[model samples]
Target: MGFWIYMLAMDLLIPLIMTGFGWYFSGRAPRKINPVFGYRTAMSMKNQDTWEFAHRHSGRIWKICGLVLLPVTVVPMLFVIGGDEGTVGTVGGIVCGVQLAVLIGSIFPTERALRKNFDKEGNRRKDGQG
Candidate 1:
């Protein structure tokens, strides 16, 4: 139980911080651009050429953090569930729950947050990129 909490603290905190950083450093604040469009705009190929100004690296960084956290998240969960159910379950559940919050809430939000404030470029918005 105690061990699970400790592991959860380590694995979950990374993603939580990553997501927080993503929001903290939001590019331009897309008050006008729609959410979906914002994502597309940031990830498109047209946004090339040393343009680390917008949500490119930040988005990628947040995503990378999430990706890394995805695997790390399993370790604590296994420890929690594999241990004794009576006592360990309670602690494990709590810790896993914390990581779950970051996984569910922050994960997608961070992705969306990446494109929260940016506009499309050029006449053709579609660059065949998904």
Candidate 2:
């Protein structure tokens, strides 16, 4: 039971973090662009406009993915509640892996959106122009 609880807490950590960071990034990303934090990418760092756009786009993705993963993670753990430590750990690890994948996978769509909305120079596109 104790180990299960511990593993459950560990597994849930990623989703919680993703959600929290998502909220922060969505509402208030750093005003200035720097290498230190808040979704740094070649395209995103092009300018203030790109920086804010990437944060807002990725933030929304993280928020939704985290919310969805929360329930998906919990359900599997609930099934393993009374299981052995190995079983609990394995399940927890799997859940964490999925959450991690979702977290990383979020970057793609944001980059795509950035490309779709803004040019390589970070200038916003006009109408259908790429």
Candidate 3:
């Protein structure tokens, strides 16, 4: 029971935090060099424009994915709280898997956006690229 509760809390809390971070940092991410925060991907860090664009794009993705995931985490909790350890573990694993999927899924769109908006040299595409 206690373990289930912890698992549920973690599933809910992690996505909530991610959502908050995405929302807050999307608009407020720094343009300068920083070790932490913001979307720090190879394509995104190509330049300031790419960096900012990726962060903003990823932020929206993360926010949406996190929001969608939050309610989902609760469903497993309801089942786990009443079910046996096996069920709890299965539910917890599923929740984690979903969360991982969401995180990984969010990156694809952001990377695609980066590729669309920027050229191979990381410069903004002005003509037909966008």
Instruction: Mark the regions of model 2 whose C-alpha exceeds 4 Å error after superposition.
Output: none
> TM-scores of the models, in the given order?
0.35, 0.95, 0.90
- Over 4 Å off in model 3, which ranges? 128-130
User: Which residue pairs collide, candidate 1?
Assistant: 30-117
Kindly report which residue pairs in candidate 2 clash with one another.
Answer: none
lDDT digits (tens) for residues 1-130 of candidate 1: 5765565566566576666655543443333434453333343324432133334445555656565665666665765554664556565556556656654554454334333433344222233232
Best by TM-score: 2
lDDT of 2 by residue, 30-95 (tens): 999999989999999999999999999899988888889889889999999899988998989888
Residue 104, candidate 2: alpha-carbon lDDT: 83
- How many clashes in candidate 3? 0
Off by over 4 Å in 1: 28-56, 63-76, 79-130
Over 3-51, each residue of candidate 3 has an lDDT whose tens digit, in order, gives: 8887888788769977997897677667674557677778888888888
lDDT score, candidate 3: 0.81
Sort every candidate by lDDT, greatest first: 2, 3, 1
Prediction 2 TM-score vs. true: 0.95
Tell me the TM-score of model 1.
0.35
